[model samples]
Structures are given as structure tokens and as C-alpha cells.
Target chain A: MEKTIGNKTVNVSEDGYLIDLNEWDKDVATAIAQEEGITLADDHWKVIEYLQNQHKNDVPLTIRSVGKSGVVDIKGFYALFPEGPLKKASRISGIPKPVSCI
Target chain B: MTKNIVILGAGTAGTMMSNHLRRALDKDWKITIIDQRTEHHYQPGYLFVPFGVYGPEDIVKPIEKFIPDGVNLKLGAIDKIYPEKDKVVMVSGEEFDYDILIVATGTDIAPEETEGMMGPHWQKDVFDFYTLEGSSALAKKFRDWEGGKLVINIVEMPIKCPVAPLEFAFLANAFFEQKGMRDKVDIVFATPMSGAFTKPKATEKLDYLLNEKNIEIVPDFNVMAVDGEAKTIMDYGGKEVSYDVLVTVPTNKGSDLMERSRIGDELNYIPTDRATLQTKVKENIFAIGDATNIPASKAGSVAHFEGEVLLENVLNYIQGKDLKEGFDGHANCFIETGHGKALLIDFNYTHEPVSGTFPFPGVGPLNLLKESRMNHMGKMAFKWIYWNMLITGRHLPFVTTKMQEAGKNFD
Candidate 1:
């Protein structure tokens, strides 16, 4: 489905995740973060940028990788995004949610 | 003039390939499979050990017993593989030059990765069931345990048999109830994922099962360290969950041999072409099962499915023919929900497990993604099928390498 975020219509999944990374923008990320009761800051942007870069390169994102990415530590990432930081930050970054083998 | 085709790790994947290639290839090809261990364990049976459903003797057999008559089973630890020279060196200074190499050295639990996991309380109050030693130790622990705040934690993602932790919680729920100590036991499932499982539909179904069984769920809890003194596991996010007894599925990493050989990723898993099972190192080198970072479940069933694709691709590589992209990451596993019931889930890289009938479609004697006594029977019967048919390179009747989309409920 498509939704308007900051005067722009973007496609997203049923859970409000961006369907296309190409469709994602700073305004979209800020909007998604704001919906999660988070205010985008310099720290959050750094993490988001790290996640987006990894996604673009076809790398799977884990809390472990994010913690080890030299961008931020796990504790700091959690403090910035609060509960379920990995998923929350991922949605804001306009990437797919993390999944493991079933 | 016979060509050498060497296979490393005589576990499920390597053993199966040896049996497969031995039967398929002519007398012109010599197949040599290597392993440090002599015992070939029925790994899936490890889950049943702690519950007293399966004894150690039942799950283990001599590794050589599975090796067919024509294939040579070399028992030795692999030191390193010099892929450029097409040779493998042993720690004992043995060497084998090969025209083709197969890497089936699967993943193993690394409890040491987490701080204090191997500490004073290790295998005493804290346990891991991924190994025969740990499972047997836990069996003894559970035999006399009074039961209070039982915590089962999966430290990270991509562990072997991802559903095993959930099954442990479910079985524990039933185990205590059978012992008439259900009230005394408070079971909590702590995991890194945000739900009962990784997939949406399966997670919903399993989450319902957790609720029905009264098992508490603590989601998105990534372990940072274990405080043995406090009997608590603290996540990186500063969340703490205390436990009376903690059963953790530690971080799983591919064999250390991968790191030594410099042919693997950070986790020591070999990078392979997902569909072709061919490694990035060379055309003659291949990988299967948990050893390869192929985005498939690290379970026996996945290995079984990958075996078919690998066999074809290997033969093609030798004959100078175009390789087939036959592998679709098909994996089918029986999710044991305890108390004479289980759920059978069949899926692949593209498809998630859906509710439907299995092999027989609508007329299925087995169900998919739904619990049934019939499915439980199928799971139990799998033990015989594994030893007699699976590793022997015999195919299951009506089961295909690619997942069947028919009779499934997909929205």
C-alpha cells in the first residue's frame, strides 16, 4: 500500500515497512521513527545510515553486526531506539525486518 | 588411473555425499571421506535425550558403519586446505591430493562466545543440548531438578534446528506436568527474535501454542553475558532475566577449520553459490549443509534436500557440462510439540511453511504447520528412516528436492 509521508506517497508493507528502499527518504524515516515515539537525532541517523549501507550491499543485519559495526554499541543502540531496537531501527532505515531460518 | 574426490567431515552431509558419489561414479573415481570423530550421532535425537525419551546409546553409532563398502573413511583431523594446490593437509602430517573437494564441516555451538557461559555454573545450572555431553549432563540435571524459573535462551539467530528451543519449552511444559511438578515449574522462552518464531504465520501459530502451554515469552533478548553468581542472563540492551536453570542454544559457528583455511566468512561458513552448491574458491570445490552460508536452515532435512542438488552439480562439474540450478533451499522438519503431538513444516527459500497436507497433498497422512498425532508418528518414524535411508543416499518416496506448493494455504 502507498502512504503519504511529508507530502510524498511511498509504498510500504502491511506493517508500514517501506517496500522499496529506493522509495525511502529522510522525511519517510523521520516519520516512521516519530510513529515509534522516537525523535531522529544524529546518533539515530548514523545507525540508520550504517543499516542502509549494509542492506544495499546485500548483507544481513543482526543486532550483533550492528553492535560490532563501529557505528554504535548494542547498549547505545538500545538507548537511542528503546525496546526492540533492531526492528525499530530497521523500519526507520527502510529495510526489511530481520529473519532467521524457520 | 583413478581420480581422488576428497570430502571433509564425516557427519550427516559429508557421509551422505560419500555414499552418493560412491554409488554414482565409476571405479575410475576414488572417494575419500575424513572425520576426526568415530561416532556418528543421530543429532536430532539429542532433543529427546534430556526428556528421557532417547538414551545416548540410541542416537549414536560407529561413523564407519555408515560409510559404504567402496568408499574409504579416513579418521583424522583436517589441519587446512590449500585450495590453490587442490590438496588437504591433516594435523598428523597426512595429506590427500584431490581433483574435487567437498566441505561438509557443519556448525557447532560456541558457548565461549558469551561471557561467563563457560563459567563456574556451566553444565551445572546452565546447560546446552546441542552436544551429547551437554544433553546427557542435562538429562542427569533434569532427573533430580525440583523445577523453578526454567529459562531456555537462544543467544543469537541462525542456530541449528531453530525450532528446537521452542520445542524444548513445550516439552518441558509437558515434562514437568507429567512429573506432577507443573505448578513448581515456570517456563520462560527467551530469544533474540521479536516473536515465537522468525516467520509471521509460523510465529503466530507457535505463539498461540506458547500461550496455550503457559510458557512465558521474552522476545528480542540478545545475550551479552551470563552472571553465574546471580543466575541471570543479561542482554546487550540492559534487560536481565534471572533463571533457576538456563538451557541456552549458544552462538553457532562453522568449523574452526574454515577460519584456519581462510576460505570462510567471519562465522567460518564457506561462501557458496546457493543454487549450484559450488564454492567461490574454485569450480571443483563444493559445500553443503551447515558449512555453507546458503540461507537455509541448519537441520538434517535441509542437508538431505541439498544432497540431491549437490550430487547432480558435482557430476556435471566432472563431465564439463553446464550446472543445474536445482537447489531451492527446500527443508522439511517435524516440530515436536510434546505429548504425542507434533507439527510438520515444509518450506524453502522462497516459501514459508503454510497450513496444508504434506507429500500426499489433500489426502495427506501428515499435516503441515498444524499439530496432529499422525505428524508425531511421522517424526518418530524418522529415526529409522534417517539411519536406513537418509544418510544411505536413498530418497524418500514422493518427496522432491523442490518444495511442492500444492495443497498449501498461501494468502
Candidate 2:
């Protein structure tokens, strides 16, 4: 199923991948860890929120650099969001457009 | 048979020229663009990427997406340009012949041009926001960064978007504040210029902001080298400053094709007439944007305005008529100061950035020299305009090709 949140349209699938809103979900967050080949802890979410709020108005959020928020271990986060915060989240959130993920 | 118009480099200038000419020219002329990369990057987004404001995925799209139909997209590195024979050689062992050529080959960061800039600490401790990789790496560094002396240094002038370093400093202050490390971080602005910006009035206002943000400014400091192990940067005058992390804007150079073609100046920039953008070496060739050694800020707005003027001249050249010398180094940039506030500056070759309103003389929702939330929004809004209208060579409603002096205060 696809849902429109704000101006962004997200895709939700059965495997727990939210295509567009992956930045906001914990499962996509964990998937981000596996791609970057790292582990995410509960503390990493704080960094994610900080990054999301910091650039929310200017750009979209993704999985690529979600782990690099400075609050989390960057190498570890790199392991999680290897491709980036936006990409990982986009894959998990099932959002059609990446801009809404921000 | 259709005439071939070859454009070098698929960056902002080349892309704009391709779109503009595609619309203006008839089907008689086949416009072909050559670039090695497949993706078109929103170069301005590089600054925001480091602060986690723009993600890597958001700023990039396939080059083919913006390129209009009927334009031949050549995805290969350009080996050399044989102006004498009117041919461009690609690294893939292919040669393209053109009746008219547009040299939109843009500039790139040459950190290695400096003595020790690209040393062991690059991206780890020393970084630049000019490239996607550098900016994203610095974003990670900015996070968990407990804060110390965050030195923002500019090695030389004539860099793309002259005010970007200052923007980085301003945003860094905001970024640290959001992270609750504002008090711990000592942000410093070091430049080769005498002031915060190139223009005097804008410089005064920006210098004031530097002070307000508690960021120190070191002016006229020509960097000699970077001692990354010692965490210090030495200037030509023997001055030294140590930093926990160094965000440096290294020297920018034109495409290597310029050097290979033996047409570029000392910095690999093409020597061109400032007004007509015609290459000094070749009468049929023209240069725009950072590729030319023009006395203008290497910015997208300059290229945008130049595209309009150059199109007219290119058509004139094709018709064997006198070319129009119409380009006035018009450049307008949105200086992001973070915290939902930014400033707009508009100037040309003759005029400096003055205090006034933009698009309108007296009535403007966007203010110049003075910081405002509207200007910041305007900055954010430009990304869409760039993608949709500008690259497509569509005419913008408010902006024009020439610089307007009506509403600006000269004094």
C-alpha cells in the first residue's frame, strides 16, 4: 500500500520496507545498518532526529549518512546506512519520491 | 545534413546551454553535449550536504533526465579539442566534428595544488564542502564533534560561489548550537581577502555577522601549507593557526582539456573576452562559467545570465553577423546563515553588492545585504527552479539577462 504523508508519497511492503519514510522507521534503520555493515543502537535514533531536523527544510532525509550524525559511531553508522540515510529510508519507506522523506 | 554544435562538460553551464539552444535553434542544428559523468549534481547542494541539510541522493539525477530530446548526449571523457580541425576527441577513441563549439567545461577543486592540503588528514580531519564525498564525510565528522577550533579557510580567490565559505561558517555556528556545542566550538573565518566578502558593503554586513556569531576572522592570510599531523596551517606570511578540524576551499582550476588543448591560462582557465565570452584564441569558440578566467564570481547565476547572452551571440555568429557583447558579470547568490535566515546579494562587473531589494527596486519580499527569513526561503526554493526551469532553458519571470541598477543603492 502507498500512503501520502504531507507532500511525499510512501510505499509500504510486506517485508517491512517502507519505501519513502524509512528515515522515520526503526526497521529501515536496522536495514540501513546491515547495508553499511554496522549495528545500530537505541542511541543512534537521537542522532537521526538531530540530522533530520537540521536539514529537514533544506533537503530530503536518507539512509546513506544517517549513521554519520556525529552522535553515533560514524564507522558503525556507515555500516548501517552505507548507501546513505535517504536511500535506506527510501527503500524501507516505499516512498515514490525521495523529497518527501526529508 | 544537420550542423553539429558540440558542448563540452555537462555541468550547470553546459546543461543550460544545451537546453537553451535546443529550444532556440531549429532542427537544422544538432546539439551534442559531452560529459564523462552520467549524473547531474546540484553543485550548490554541496554546502548543505556536509551539515546534513542535503543528502547525496536528493541532489543527483541522471543527466539524461534534464537533457531535452533531439540533443545528442555523449557519455565519455573528452580527451582533447582540435580547434584547428574543428573536432573534439573523446577518451573512448571517438571523434566528434562540430561547426560551432561551446566550451562550458567547468572548474574543479585542486586541493593538491596546495603544498599539504590533500595530505593524510583529508576528509578525516581536513575537508571541503565542494565535492559530494567530502561534504558527506564532513557531516559525519561534524556529528559527535565535541567542538574545538573549527577553522574555515579559503586558499585563493575566483572560486565557485565566493560566499560559500562564509555560509559554511555561519551554518557551522548554527549546527553547533543545535548540537549544544556552540560554546565549545570556536569557529574562525580565514581568507585571502581583506574582508568577509569581495564587495565592501556586503563585506561589512557579513563581518558583523561573523562577530555576532562569535566567529573570528583572519584576513589576507595566504596559506602556504597544511601540517595535518601538527593540526596547524601556515600562511605565506609565517602566521599559523591550529585547528581540531580544517574546512578548506582549495584552489579551483578549469577542465584539464584546456591545458591539453593548450588554450588555457596559468590556472587552466580559458582566456576570454569578459563581455562576449569569446575565447581569445579561437573566434568561433566561447567560454562560460568557471571555465573562463573572467573577472566575475564563478557562480550559477552568472552562467544563467551568460547563457542568454551567449545564445544571442552564437546565433549571430552562425548567421555571419556581428556578435553582441552583452554579458555583464551579473551574479546573484543566496548566502545561507542558518537558523531559517539567509541573505541575497546581486552585483555585476561594474557594481558591488549593495543594500537593497531584489527583482523589485523598492518593494521586494527578498532583501539584499540584510538577513531575512524570506531570502532563506528563496534560497531553498531555487533548487526546484534550477531543476525545472533554468536547466530547461525556460525564461524566468523576474530575472533578466542584464544587470538592473534601478532599485539598488550605489552609495
Best by TM-score: 1
Candidate 2, after superposition: displacement of residue B383 in Å?
0.6
| TM-score for candidate 2 | 0.79
Task: Please identify model 1 stretches exceeding 4 Å from their true place.
Answer: none
Pick the lDDT winner. Answer: 1
User: Every model's DockQ, to 2 decimals?
Assistant: 0.55, 0.01
Write the residue-wise lDDT of candidate 1 on B72-136 in tens digits: 89998999999999999999999999999999999999999999999879899999999999999
lDDT of 2 by residue, B1-411 (tens): 789899998888899899889988999899999999999999889989878888978799999888889899999999999999999998888999999889988999999977888867999899999999999999999878887899999987668888899999999999888888799999889887777987777888999999999999998666768998999998755689999999999988888998899988667888888898888878888888889877788988888999898999998999998988899889989999989899999988878889888888899878988899999999999999989887777777898788889888886
lDDT of 1: 0.91
Give TM-scores of chain A for all candidates. 0.93, 0.38
